[model samples]
Target: MTVPTEEVAGAGAPEPSAQPWWRSAVVYAVYPTSFADGNGDRIGDLRGLRERLDYIAGLGADAIWLCPWNPSPMADGGYDVSDYCDINPMLGTLEEARALIEDVHAHGMRLIVDLVANHTSNEHPWFRAALAAPVGSPERERYLFRDGRGAHGELPPNAWISAFGDSGWTRVTEPDGTPGQWYFHTFAPEQPDLDWSREQVRADFDAIMRFWFDLGVDGLRVDAAPAMAKEPGLPDYDLTSYGDPTVFRSSVWVDSPQWDTPGIHEIMRRFRSVAREYGEDRMFVAEAVVSSSQRLADYVRPDELNTAFNFQFLKEPWGPGLRDVIDETLRLHAEVGAPPTWCLSSHDEIRLATRLGRTDTTAVHLVDPATAPTDLELASIFHRSGEWVSLASLPGSWA
Candidate 1:
């Protein structure tokens, strides 16, 4: 299985010292909602994060990738951003966020925040204006709002499914309480997908990037990076024809007009330029959930994002499958001269220990909520020295 090098050829190389700090850094992902609750509000806030900075620094993590702390409605676990510039009041004020950054820097650790460019909360001012505006109005153009299919315009515009297991299109209610056009949402309906084809959308993201970068954010972890750019003209797809729809490896998922399109690379390149304007140390990492190693590598090319999460490694089972994914990830990243990121678990994923102790370890285990091991089973795995050694071997870093 020979890997192609054309995608990386002639890519402008940065000087070794100018390389982003994330290349060999251990970045600990912090879910701010649960990390700690400093104000006794039963919800974690910037104060909590600030209080725990020492613990994170002591853990030897070079940086901390914070999940969305931006003002959100808590829909989709804070992925539905309502305001890009302000911090969530429930989380803390903007002053606290700034102080957290200063504290992180004081602890000798860098800070990166999640950037959800693919979608925005339904409560966002732009989206609210879009709901009131007539179809084809300038406000509507900010999102992927389109006329529904069928004679009565009752059917969805396309056969696309949401990542959360439902139709991707959500019909809106017009100001006069009439049925309205449907809008695309890759995730939940509250999180409507933005129409990246619009220059205004691109410009808005550029401002959002600068807003954080200028405030001293070290990096951004772009959420749903690949889905930002969709193939023109939403098309119907046959989900049944693809084997194992649950696995991203299925052709239905990979070849869909909705994901990993070539246009997304250009969008990423533009984002790369924005990061470059900040300094060599500023970085962008993509959360592109494609199944192919080559497709994943494309996201981290020299002129694109600095790195991307290796979901292939995250979803692989123990033994040969895991080893093969690690090896291929290292090789593919090497071809692009990019570093690979590794993780056993994330806020959206089950804990690493529980996942490894289960009898069936596959992507299916993740989707099936009931597949978790019993308490005794988990205890047994923890008590075994051999299991501990095997679990330790599962963590892989960039070579």
Candidate 2:
């Protein structure tokens, strides 16, 4: 697809100084365990993060966005949070988190915590309570549930595929003798999806954010927001080639209503409203992945997230043809009118160095998609994308 560069030329006017520093600041994404090790425990903790604050600050990042350090089963690498209120025992404690935040602030940098509101760890008390509560009970309503035996119940809520290539739903059994029921999880079987349609669920999340916002968090990085809302009827799809269940447990709802759900926007607006109440400016960076640029732009409008990561670069082939992709990248953001957040690499991606041709130039030269090796082109695409894009963790002056 050809992306025009008109939008890049008109992306934004100069920002006023009074605006939040994060809005214009570069960020460094830190995976705690890999960033540094404190106490020589071989795991990254808040204390380790504190000790490395200078390294991060030296990178010239305006802030450090910590991946979920909350207590978790680590089934999906800490995304499955068991306690939003406490730091992971593997990472540190509440006291350490406080110190990390203080240390980050002292370095003239802010902290953006990852809030995976879409789901939580199976070990979480909420999920355990949800398992025991009756279908109509307040606790049960916190999670997505369907009768396991009914015709509609036999299938999951929808056919939406999980990001991880598996059925998002899992059967829940009770300690007492009882029929098993399906619980929705868009990503992993162990990460139960929240029933955002339920009022109590929304309230619980609001309170969860408040618990942290009140603790002085600067912002939040929302994970998989587009999948937050599921279809009400919970439709199913034809089986996949492997004969796996067509319906992913997490989403009973798919494009039936619209690609982007109204409920998702409502929830984001509520989050933003609450963020405004706090003294710090709460910036929302949406991690939305979609095929069409129009669909991606929909997530970053004035009312939704402040910015969304552009995946065009991630999908492009490296070479001179990359100019079109880079141009398109800037153009797409310009059209959205939201400041673009360029991403060459994230946790989910293979390192850029590995993608490029393993040569001295590191695949910097562009190649023709029709003739060049796919890997070489991809490497070049990522290399060029990084040249001008701002990342949460990488140095801004790269390339």
Count of clashing residue pairs in every prediction: 0, 18
Q: Give all TM-scores, in the order shown.
A: 0.87, 0.80
Q: Give the TM-score of candidate 2.
A: 0.80
The lDDT, on a scale of 0 to 1, for candidate 2 is 0.66
Q: Which stretches of candidate 1 lie over 4 Å from their true place?
A: 1-19, 244-252, 358-399
Q: lDDT, candidate 2, residue 322? A: 67
Query: What does candidate 1's lDDT look like per residue over 91-113, in tens digits?
Result: 99987887887778777777889
